[model samples]
Target: MAEDGRERLGIVAGGGGLPMIVANAAIEKGMEPVFARFSDGMTNDSIIGRSRAFAWGRTGDAIEWLKAEGVQKLVFCGTISSRPDFRSILPSFKTLKRLPRALRIVKGGDDRLLRNLSRYLESEGFDLLPVQAVAPELLAPEGVLTARTPTAEESAALDLAHRAATALGVLDAGQAVIASNERIIAMEGIEGTRAMMRRVAEYRAARKIGRGERLALVKAVKPGQDRRFDLPSIGVQTIDEAEAAGITAIGVSAGESLILGFDDVIDRANTAGLAVCGLGGEQGTAR
Candidate 1:
């Protein structure tokens, strides 16, 4: 438990409900949470009640505010889909020193970038904590969670999709795949899982698919991905998207992926006749 005066959790939130979940979990643990989100990343209505707003290039100011608030621990959550406008990123004298390194950071791939940012944050005296540090229950558990279970065919397809997704993770490409009858149908790209599922939905609508075969929506954690930032996370919307895409089963990396709104997600999946299962694997990559 944190002390009354000198301890607080600074939540650097992004787009999604996961940040709210994390904040609530921290609050339950007796830590005051300062919910801060980027100006462009607060697309979720859940962040509306109480929050601290910060601009993209104002890390120096944000850090000072958190320090003043006694927020010694920091947790980064949510999806930052928008690229920083370099023009707006003008650096002050204090932030000017970090700007060059930050610019170089953007040159690397996602994993490299996350690692660099984590290190930078630690160097600045803030303790970077994993999301699970505050919310262990958010981690997806092993085995099926819904009333429906994957059929024998969908089981095999899940295996195939998991393998393909892992291979793709090796290239830092994507974390999710859609498969049927042991054949890969679609893979998540930069457009993300929802968009990929929508594509599958369009295909199903156009061709009248699902010939008694289950569509498997498989999501895996990226191989060697920094858990502090991009651990694979799913919410209730994922279930609705999968069901709309004709997905009969959903498999995520057990113990590694974050299952936001787990109970509600499972309840909706069961009601929609979709199976939500967790698959085990190593290095956060589901097998």
Candidate 2:
């Protein structure tokens, strides 16, 4: 707690355990976390126990709630589905007027929207903190995660996929992309990574025979992305889905992407004989 009353931390939570993780981390740091959640696209009630939780509709209402709670700092975390249908935002009059302009500026993707939102919040006197500022351990470490390193061909495929995915991210498109044999099999769009991978697997199955070999999945962050929200994240479930989809290698940004389950995810990748690498720069050599 700081001199300004109780030091309150604001969390704009979406779906998944990431929000809970952020709340717990804040608690450990001795700051009170106040969660502002959306009714349709947020975590379960269990998160309430970890922090001061409130349900809000419009973005204006959310900001008001945070201001009312005396939150001086803000953190945005978790999986907010990229698809428009998954979001049930009820912007207030002020937010509604600014919404279109912000959407047009950022193209309405997770990273862009959140960055603009952070700027808006800052203009209103709230300081938005980096998501990693509270959960540093979530950042993916540089190295080969699995026991087996990527083969030469798989490494090449990963390199290509990484560049493509990063470019897509810059366009506010998506975070993950699937590539094999120097061809883009699938690019993540409004649907999440798992859905894209599942679609790619279905397509491969339809092709039959020689086409079913292991594919490379690359997840990267946009070069200038704001780290407060929609940072690329993977976990044990991500590894399980990759293995089930017959993915051979998973490449993520060395320091930018987050690995939620960290050890468990790496263990599963190693057990499944899959290659996981945190890649950086133009060079794609396995770490």
Candidate 3:
């Protein structure tokens, strides 16, 4: 709690800008933001307010740090570039006590891992908050957000991409898929959406094709995913990457995905003459 007695939110920072964005948003809503950084070394030191860094296996330490900071609500945000090296994890007494459950988390896919992690944290007494709950305004509303609405072909491509994303989600593989010429060309993996975009760009350049109106990328939440962690998110960076990948339009699950820096994302998409739409339907519905 703050000196003013307001609750403080503990943000588990990862590799992207979303963590900071969430932290700032929490502050605007009168909640103090405390950070818990991981040993992956991806989270930068540009964070505001109090923070503590811990190794992947040091769950007990992290919980202690959050408790000390008076954080009762916690949210996980941003991208994780790599998985932890289990061999390198220095076992603390706390970690060893929870080894079996921790193993279950690390051994699963991204969605499973996060779901288990959220459950574990909540079991330990912290209120796990989802990104949408933390910042409702950041949720992408259903509509065309760009200066130009998607062309019929682009919209069709988006539909195809959405289906592909759903399958990807069901597999607990990833949240994004790129579609062009009525087919999915790529799906996001552990490397993340930006890396998948780069791969699409490479494929297009290599083939010297598919750089037209039918290309679209759709990002959506995995079916039955725990909303408290690893929600699909996009920002101005997503716009820039999609543009670079020769993607004609972008579709995101409405209310299920987070749009970091919403205005900046729209402006970037408009400037690039790219269509950005928040898709709504069975797949895009919020949990």
Candidate 4:
């Protein structure tokens, strides 16, 4: 807590706009935001003043810095594009004791890895908060968001994509899938959503299909996923990628996925004539 009685929030930032978005929201809510920036992660420059940089393997250093900053609540946002190189680990005495467990966590599948990592962090005496807990405005709302509601065929495709995405998530595999012409063409893997979309684009192009063909991109939270972190997210860039990949519609689990720049995402999808909707309980309202 600060002298003003506001909690100091620690953001473990990686690549993308999300860390900055969370920081801005924390500030608005009267929290002091401190950053633990990964050296290889693409942290935005705007928050540099309050950030301390640490390498992926320097767990001890990062935690020590956050503690020194008086942060008790930590939230993780953005993407860690690749796994850390265990060979490069530089452990201090404090973390060295837990090094073996950390290695095993890294060896597990994505969901199991995150669940264990959350426990590991909690063991370090800090409370973990999910992104939506700090910034509920970022959560995607239910119902169609764009001017173009999905066609009946496109809606059916969206349902197929969602089912495919859930299957991928159940395996701790990935969160997004592209279904085209009633068939699953791609399921995100370690390559991620952007790469998967690019692959879809290339596949379509190879078959001599032009832009704006029929397809849907759907993302969902893994069944029994730890909601404390790593919720699947989409943004304006998602719309751009979908358009590029010839996807005509996009669906995400309502209140279960983040839609960064929500209005902009809707506007972009509308302008592109793509259908965007959230699939789940009809309880959320558009922000």
The prediction achieving the highest TM-score against the true structure is 3
TM-score of each: 0.91, 0.86, 0.94, 0.93
Query: What clash count does candidate 3 reach?
Result: 0
lDDT of 3 at 224: 75
lDDT of each: 0.80, 0.76, 0.83, 0.83
lDDT of 1 by residue, 74-189 (tens): 99988877667767866666566667776766656677777887887788798999999999999999887888777887788788888889999898888899988657889987
lDDT of 3 by residue, 1-287 (tens): 88888779999999888888888889889898899998668897687777888998788888888988888999888777788776789899888888888888777898778878878888989998887787889888987887898877787888888988888788988888998746778887877888889988898889745445368889988887887777788898888888888997898888888888888899888999988988886643211
Clash numbers, per candidate: 0, 0, 0, 0
lDDT of 2 by residue, 165-208 (tens): 97897797888888875677789988899898788768767774
Residue 193 local lDDT, model 3 = 87
In candidate 2, how many Å is residue 87 off?
A: 13
Q: Rank the candidates by TM-score, best first.
A: 3, 4, 1, 2
Candidate 3 — which residues are off by over 4 angstroms? Answer: 211-213, 283-287
